[model samples]
Target chain A: MDQFTLNLLFVGASFALYIGIAVWARAGSTAEFYAAGRGVHPVTNGMATAADWMSAASFISMAGLIAFTGFDNSSFLMGWTGGYVLLALLLAPYLRKFGKFTVSEFIGDRFYSPTARLVAVICLLVASITYVIGQMQGVGIAFGRFLEVDAFWGLLIGACVVFAYAVFGGMKGVTYTQVAQYCVLITAYTIPAIFISLQLTGTPIPALGLFSEYTPGGEPSGVYLLTKLDQIVTDLGFASYTEAHRDNLNMVLFTLSLMIGTAGLPHVIMRFFTVPRVSDARWSAGWTLVFIALLYLTAPAVGAMARLNISEMMWPNGTEGAAVSVETIETDPRYNWMLTWQKTGLLDWEDKNGDGLIQYYNDGSEALAARAAENGWEGNELTNFNRDILVLANPEIANLPGWVIGLVAAGGLAAALSTAAGLLLAISSAVSHDLVKGAIAPGISEKGELLAARISMAAAIVVAVILGLNPPGFAAQTVALAFGLAAASIFPALMMGIFSKRVNNVGAVSGMMAGLLFTLIYIFLHKGWFFIPGTNSFADTVDGSLLGIQSTAIGAIGALLNFAVAFGVSSMTAETPQEIKDLVESVRTPRGAGAAAADH
Target chain B: MDQANQTPAVDKEGRTYWKANIRLIAWSLAIWALVSFGFGILLRPLLKGIEIGGTDLGFWFAQQGSILVFLALIFFYAWRMNKLDRFYGVDEE
Candidate 1:
C-alpha cells in the first residue's frame, strides 16, 4: 500500500476502536455521565488521565521546544509532572472524599456560596475552552497532514467523532476511549524514539541512549551524545545543549505556574472524582505520573537526537566543511523527507546569494558571522522550519518504515481527540451539573440533567470546531492564558478550600477574581489586550517584563496575591460557619466516601 | 450530612489522621522542591563536577533524575497514606 493508504488504515482502525468503546460504554444516567458511576479502577483512571492530560502540545510540540532550546526548556518537563505531587498530596484524595461529580460542586458546597461556584465555573470555562481550542486545532492539523485534506474537513470529522463518543458515553465513554488512546499515542511516540536511539547511540532505551556515547555505524565513538551535540551546535552558533542559560527566577516561577496549573485544570481534577475511593485517588495520581513519565523521559532524547540529525543533514560534509548543495537536497533519496515537508509550507529553504550550497546556521550569532564571512556564505538558508513538524516528520527523517509514519498519524489524532473529549466533559458538567442544577433550575430531574449534559457537550464540541478552524492569532498566548488562569485562580482557591476552613465565601470569590484579573491584565499588557495584534502596551521581552518575570511566569505571583487577598479579606469579614468547617473536616478524612453524589 | 454521621470519637480520630497526613505532605513537598527546584535549577552550579553519563549531575536531575524522584515520592506517599487510613479506621469498605 502507498503511504497515504497506510495512514488511512491506521487512523481508521483507531477511530473504529474509539467509537466502539463509546457505543459499548454509553452513559445511561447522570451518575455514569458525570463521574463514570464512580466505579473506574485507579489504574484505568490513571491511564485515561494520562491520555487526557497529554494533549497535542505534549505529544507534538514539547519535544521540539526542548530540542531547540536545550536545558533551559527543562521547565516544561519538570513543571508539567511536578504538579501531580501537589495533586496527590494536597488535592486529589480530599476532593475524592468529598464525592462530587464536578469540581465547582466542591467549591459551591465547601464555600457555601452559589456565587463562588459561578465564579469557579467561569474560571473553569475560560481555562477549558481555551485549552480545547488548541486541541481541536491540533486535531485538524493532524487530520490535514494524514488525510491529505484541508484543515476544515479534518476539524469537521474530528468534531463529529468527538460528538459521537462524548455526547453518548459521557465520562464513562471518554474514560475508556482515552485509555485506548493513551496506548496508541505512547506506542507511536516510543517506537520512533527507540528506533532513533538505536540508530544514534546503539541504546534501545531512548532515556539511557540520551546519556550514552554517540555510536555511528554500530560502533561507539568514545564521545557522549550530549557532548558531541554541544560541540556541533555551538559550532553552528547555538548555545550548549546541557548548560542553563535562562533567567533563574523566571524559570522557577514559570515551572511553578505549570505545576499549579496542572493540578488545577478542571478536566484533570475531575478524573480523580471517577475513582471508587479516596486512596484510589491518591494511587491514581501516581499512576497518571507513571504513564506520563514514559513520554516525558523519552522526549528530551528525541529533541537532542533530532537536533543532531538536522545539523548533520545540513552540513553533510561536516560543520567545518562546505554546506549541503541545493542540488543534492533536491534529488537525494536520503533528503526526501525535506521535500515532502516543504510541500506543507512549514519547512522551506532558499540558496541565498545564488550559491548552490544552502547554509544553515544562526545568522544572529556574532561568532558565526565571522565564520560565514570566511566561508563566503550569505545567510542561513533553512529559514522557515516550524518546530511542530519535528515530531510528525521524525519517523520519515530517520527513514523508518512507512507503517511507523502511519502509527504516528493515528497517535497524534488520539492525543488531540482524547484531550478534546475530556475538556468537553468538564465544560458540560459545569454547565449542566453545577450551573443548571445548582443555580438555575434546582427542580430539574436527573434525566433532564443528563440530556442537558449531552446537549452542552455537543455545544462545546461545536464551539471547539469553529475556534479550531479560525483560531485567534495568538495560539501560544491563549495557551499561556489558560495556564495562567488555572494557576492563579482555580488552583489557589481549591487548595485554600481544602487546606483551610477559615477562608469564607467572600474571601474565596474575591481572591479568585483578583488572581484572574491580575494575571489576565499582565498577560494582556505583554501579549496584547484580548490577544489583538498591535494592542500590546509592553513588549514580551525580558527587559519589558515586570521584575524580569514574563507574562507566562506571572501566574505564580498572581497565586501569591490570591493567598494574601483571601486571608486578608477573610480576617476582616465574617468567619466561616461551623457546619462549613465541619464539611472541610469531613473531606479531609477517607471514611464514608461511598459514591459520588450530587447535593442540591 | 457528614457532621451528623460523625461522633466525637470518629471526629477525634479523623483530626489526628488529618494531622499525620499534613506532616507527610510537608515532608514530601520539601523533597520535591529540593530535587527539582533546588538541584535542577538553583543549586546546579554546586554539582558541576559530579559528572555522570555525559553531563553533570544537575543536568541529569533537570531532565531525568528529578522526574524519577517525583515518581518515587508519589508512590511512597500513596502507600503510606493508605496505611494511615487503615490504621486510623478511616478506610472505606
Candidate 2:
C-alpha cells in the first residue's frame, strides 16, 4: 500500500481499539465516571498519566524547539518533568487522602468556604479550556495532514469520536485508552530515534547515541556527536548547540513556572485521584516521569540528529562546498520529503539571487556577510522551513521505512486525542461535580449527577472543537496564559490548603485573585491586552519585559506573590477555625483513605 | 472505635510523622533545586572543566541526570514514607 493508505490503516486500527475499549469499560457509577472507581494500579495509572500529560506540543513541537534553540531550550524538558517531584512530594498523596471527587471540592471543604471552591472552579475552567483548545487544534492539524481532508472536517470527525469515548466511558475509559496511547506514541517516537541513532552514531539507544561518537558512513568518527553538531551549526553562523545563550535568571524562572504549572494542571492532578491508595499516588507520580522520560531523553537526540541531517542534505559536499543546485533539489529522490511538505505550504524555498543554488545559512550573521558577498548570494534561499514539521517529517528525512512514517502519523493523532480527552474530563467534572452538584444543586442524586457529568463532557468537547476551528490569533499566546494562571493561582491555593491551617477562606480567595490578575495583566501588558494586536504597552521581548522577566517566566514571580499575599492576609485576619485545623491534620495522614468520598 | 480511645497518643504520633515527612521533603527539594537550577544553570560555568560527551557535566545534568535523580528521589520518598506509616501504625488496612 501507498503511504496515505498505510496511514489510514494505522490510524483506523488505533481508533477501533480505543473505541472498543471505551465501550467495554463504560462507566457505571459517579465514582467510576470521575475517578475510575479508585482501583487503578499505580503503574497503570502512571502510564495513563504520561499519555495525558504529553500533548501535541511534547510530541511534535518540543523536539523541534530544542533542535533550533539548543541548550537554551532544555528548560522545556527539565521544567515539564521536575513538576512531578512537587506533585509527588507536596500535593498528590494528601489530595488522594482527602478522598475528594474534584480539586475544587478539596479546596471548598478544606477552607470551609463555597467561594473558595467557586474560585478554584473558575481557575480550572480557564486553564483547562485554554489547554483543550490547543489539543483540539492539534488533532485537526494531524488529521488534516494524514487523512488529506479539510481541517474542519477532520476536526469534526475526531471530536465526535473522542466525545463518544470520553462521555460514555468517562475517566475509566480514558485511562485505559491513554495507556494504549502511551504505548503507541512511545513506540512510534522511539523506533525512528533508534534507527536514526544507529545510523548516525552506531548506537542503539538514542540517549546514549547522543553522547557517543559520530559515525559517518556507519564508521566511528573520533569526534563526539554533540561536538560535531556544535561545529556544523556554529560554522553556519548559528550559535553553538551545546552552550547556553539564554539569560540565566529568565531561564530559571521559566523552568520554575513550567514545573509548577505541570503540577498545577487540573487534568494531571486528577490522574492521581484514580489510584487506590495514598502511597500509590506517590509511586504513580514516579511512574509517570519514567514513561515521560522515555520520550524526553530520546527527544534531544532526535532533535540534534535531525539538525545534522538537514545540514548534510543542504551541504551535500560539506558546508564549505558550493550550495546544492536548484536542479538537484528538483530531481533528487533525497529531496522528495521537502517536496511533499511543500505541497502543504509549510515548507518552501526560493532562489532569490537567481543563482540556481539554494543556500541555507544564518543570513543575519555578520560573519556570514563576507561569505555571502563573495558567493554573490542575496540572502538565505531556503525560506519558510517551519519547525513544527521537523518531528513529523523526521522519519522521511532520514529515509526510514514507510511503515515508520505511518506509525508517526498515528502517534501524533494519539497524543493529541488522548490529551484532549483528559482535558475534557477535567472540564466536565469541574462543571457537573464542583459547580452544579457542589453549589447549584447540592441535593443532586447520584444518577442525576452522572447524567450531568456526561452532558457537561459533551458540552466541553463542543466548545473545544468550535474554538479550535476559529482559533484566535492568540491561540499560541493563550498557552502561556494557561500555564501562568495555573502556576500562579491553582498550585499555591492547593498547597496552602493542605500545608497551612491558618490560611482562611478570605486569604486563599484573595491570594488566588492576586496571583491570577497579576500574571494576566503582566502577560497582557507584553503580549497585548487580552492579546489584541498592537494594543500591548510593551513589546514581548527581553528589552520590553518588566524587570527583565519575560511574560512566560513571570509565573514563578506570580507564585511567589501568591505565597506572600496568602501569608500576609492570613496573619492579619482572624485565625483558622479549630475544626479546619483538625481537617488539615487528618488530610496529612494516609490511614483512612480506603475509598474516594463525595463531599456532599 | 479503638482509635477514638487512643486520640492523644495518635495525635502525638501524627505530628512526629509529619515532622519526619517534612524533613525528607526538605532534603529532596534541596537536591532537586541543586541539580536543575544550580548545576544546570547558575553553576554550569563552574563545572565546565568536568566534560562529558564533549560538553560540560552541567549540560548532561540539564538534559538527563536531573530527570534520573528525580525518579530515584520519588521512589525513595515513597518507600521511606510507607515504612514510616507502618511503623507509626498509620498504614491503611
Over 4 Å off, model 1: A27-31, A149-174, A436-480, B1-4, B9-12
User: Can you write out model 1's per-residue Cα lDDT over A537-588, one digit (the tens) per residue?
Assistant: 8877678876578887888988999999999999999999988887887887
Q: Any runs in candidate 2 off by more than 4 Å, and if so which? A: A27-31, A149-174, A440-481, B1-10
Cα RMSD to the true fold for all candidates: 2.7, 2.9
Looking at model 2, the pairs that clash are none
C-alpha TM-score for every candidate = 0.94, 0.93
Name the lDDT of candidate 1: 0.84
Top candidate on lDDT is: 1
> Candidate 2 lDDT, tens digit per residue, B39-93?
9899999999998987989998998888888889999999999999899877775
> lDDT for each of the candidates?
0.84, 0.83
Chain A only, candidate 1, TM-score: 0.93
lDDT of 1 at A465: 71
